[model samples]
Target: MLEIKNIVKQYANHRALDDVSTRVEQGSIFGLLGPNGAGKTSLIRIINQITAPDSGEVFFDGQPLSPDHIGRIGYLPEERGLYKKMEIGEQMLYLAQLKGLSKQEATSRIKHWFEKMEMQSWWHKKVEDLSKGMQQKVQFVATVVHQPDLIILDEPFTGFDPVNVNIIKEEILSLNRNGATIIFSTHRMESVEELCDSIVLINKSKKILDGKVREIKKAYRTNTYRVEHLSHDVQLASVEGLFAIESREDKGENTALTIKIAAGRTINDVLAHLLPIVQIHELKEIIPSIHDIFVQQVTTKASNPLISEQE
Candidate 1:
């Protein structure tokens, strides 16, 4: 649904983005990931037309992005903005109208969202009277009331409690199911794992990784496995073909071990030898988490400046 091509942005001597490019598929939740000052906000601003890139282009639905496309996109910026004195319903209706909805249309949509989000009783309350989480819900409703084709959510669950978080998560899934494309940006890697179909990781003003979540995890695999067995003597020394033991801990009657396989051995081969020696309970591959991948990529880039230069 969206394509960012070779976008570059500079401010004085610093480059916020350097020829970064990525695609957002229709009806899919796409993750935009990076550490602080990684140019994530810069790219997001460019996409929203809050700022223009120094060079390159952004395309929406195969055409060059422009002001006319603004109404089709909903943006919830990381910095929350709401009129403190405005009533919940009034504020939402105003924002919806700004997105090009007629007053009657906005009221209808706002009413539906307020009811669906269980905020019907809070409609008359002022923004300042609500809790942080409650205010977040108000902003969320305001963002989607216009039924934008693309929704850009930055740190969407920032102040939400677990219950409300789950509520929003379900709504996001429902939105996707109903044909709204999502570009989710957050520091919470666990959320990415749960919701994103694909992701793009940027660091030091450049795109370092981009692919399907499962494919990226598979490509980053280290041939490590978490094995649980009844015996405690399943040490690295006792296990044949084990290159190294990453960690070991006791879990009730079973001892869990994370071991790296030797170069010439496979996980199945290692398991074959281990199964005979110990009563195996569980064995699973240790897939790297998005947090691990982020750290690994950013740290490696920082340590090797030449690598980023080459890219």
Candidate 2:
């Protein structure tokens, strides 16, 4: 739904983004990931037209993004903004109208969303009176009331309890199922793995990774395997091609061991020695988590700047 091409943004002597490009598919939840100072906020601001790129182009639905597209998009910035003394419903109405919804339309949409989000009793509450999590819910409803084609949420799940987090998560999924394209930006890797179908990783003002979540994890596999078998004497089992034992645990009569496959050998080679003395019950290859991939990639880039030069 959105295409950013060779985007570059800078401020004075510092560069925020450099020749970065990525695609957001229609009806897909795309995760925008990066560590601090990675230019993620700069790129997001460019997409929202809050700022213009020094040299780049953004296309929306195959058309060059223009003023007319503003109403068709919704943005919830990381920083929450609400008038402290204003009534919740009134503030929501004001924000909705700014997104091009009429008073009547805005009221209707607001009412529905408020009730759906279990904020019906909060309409008359003052922004200052509500807790942080309550205020987040109010802002969330205000963002989606206009039902924009593309929704951008940065650090959206911040300051919420787990129950409310799950509630908002379901709502986001429901929106996607109903044909809304979402660009989710957050430091939370678990949420990305659970909700994002694809993602783009940025660091040091450049795009470092982009692909399906499952595929990215598979590509980052460390050839580690977890094996479970009947406990036996350590000396009786021939350990071949075993680099290291990542972990070991005894469960009643069975023992579980996580071992990395040694270089120059595969899982089959590791099994060749253990199968003789131990009756194997379970064996599976270990895939790296999104958090692991994030740290590994960013750390590698920091240590060796030339690693991602191929991009």
Candidate 3:
């Protein structure tokens, strides 16, 4: 439930965001992606009302974004902030109240989250006494203790080992499952692929790509497939003009092949030609990862400044 329309932000000679627009569907995990200085942060700040766009508008739940909507939003910035001397539980209570929670309500939520995360023993620990990961958990609790309608996370997985990353990831999914709309911003494309239903790619202060994850991947699909089959007297070289073998590997009695369909040739045509010479075991199309598309989009825009405008 957020819509950003034709946002433009600038500072002196540098334009941070330029005519960028995107929509986040209610209860969906939307990814805000871009490389450094691509205006992702600028757009995020605008959404958080940390700064206003020089032009354009943002709507929260179909209405113009205003101070009243602040309580309904939770933001966890990339730079972690916590009172070093404050006890973990005390800090959480204060932050939650800032989001409009009553003291009693904040305490209840803080206790619930602390128990849920198995960090009940950390309530009395001071922020400076905790490790980076521990402090991160405390900050995360402070952010969501108020149960805001929209949660904005930037580089949220930083400073955690794989196990802790998975822990935080599960919590994010749980929030989404419970009907919280999330705006996830990170450099981790793998996370975006795993967590986001849709995404918008920004580059050089402009929107280069924006769509549902599945549709975006479908649009970038190449006619490539991986084939595995028994190698009983197989002669792949004999089957020419059907597909180009990109890679081939021998797995004992089986052969694995990565092939791209030849011009005017269908996938079934390649399968038809290969089925006779070998016992086909497995076949699947090779889908490009979000990381691949991210790099491609950024690099393409870098080379062609007008690419965003054209799209």
Candidate 4:
């Protein structure tokens, strides 16, 4: 339910976002992916109205982004901070009220969150006494307590241990399930694969890719397959439309082979031609991970000294 349209932002000698555009669907988790200096933060700030873009516009739901939309969005930045002397429950209540909740409502919501996240015991503790990860949990609670229609989280899993990471992940999924749309930004491509329905990858201030996660993975399919069969010994080249035998292993009972399809041919073509000589057993196609696609695409876009380090 957010649309970033041809947005551009410039700071002194650097152009941060350059005509970047993407759409995030309502009630779905959308991933905002980019390496350092890829203008991702610029676009996020514009969406939050923390910084104005030099040109272009953002649409929230069906309307142009406006001050009224502020209460409908929640943002969690990478940096975590809390009032050192403030009690966790008190701070959370204060922040929730600022998001338009009444004191009673804030108190109720904070209690639920504290219980769900298993932080009820820490509610009376001062922020200064909390660990880094604990403070992150507090920040997350404060950010989304009002249940905004759109939630933007940058590096949300940074300080979370694996168990806590899964906790946050489940909470995010729950929010989306309750009709909130999410814009998640992180360096972890695996999380994107798990959480995002769609994603946009920005590199050098450009939208290099945007598509449904499954569709994007399908587009990058290598046409590589793993096959296992009990067969007569045969020449590898005899099969038509088979590019190469990428790997082979001889088990005592059955032989397994990894094969690549020739360009512009279907797996069926290989199977049909090979089934005559070999007793077919199993076949599976290989698909590239989002991380693989991210690295490959961004790497080909630039030759800068630091671009190689981007992923």
For candidate 4, the per-residue lDDT at 132 reads 86
Best by lDDT: 3
Model 4 stretches with alpha carbons more than 4 Å out: 230-240, 249-255, 301-311
Q: With candidate 3 superimposed using the best TM-score fit, by how many Å does residue 272's alpha carbon deviate from the native? A: 1.3
Q: Which stretches of candidate 1 lie over 4 Å from their true place?
A: 232-243, 302-311
Instruction: Tell me the TM-score of each prediction against the true structure.
Output: 0.92, 0.91, 0.95, 0.91
lDDT (Cα) of model 3: 0.89
Candidate 2: tens digits of C-alpha lDDT, residues 22-52: 8999999999999999999999899999999
Q: Following a full C-alpha superposition, what root-mean-square deviation does model 3 have from the true structure? A: 2.3
Question: How many steric overlaps does candidate 4 have?
Answer: 0
For residues 1-311, could you state the per-residue lDDT of candidate 1 as single tens digits?
A: 99999999999999999999889999999999999999999999999999999999999999999999999998888887999999888888888889999999998988898889999999899999999899899889887888889999999998999999999999999998999999999999999999999999888899888888988887777888888888555443445555577788878888888888988888878877766678888989988997898788878754322223436
Please give the lDDT score at residue 192 for candidate 4: 96
Worst 10 residues of 4 by lDDT: 302-311
Tell me the TM-score of model 1: 0.92
lDDT of 4 by residue, 144-202 (tens): 99989999999999878999999999999999999999999999999999999999989
Q: Candidate 3: where are CA atoms >4 Å away? A: 238-241, 301-311
Higher lDDT: candidate 1 or 4? 1
Candidate with best TM-score? 3
Clashes per candidate, residues 3 or more apart or on different chains: 0, 0, 0, 0
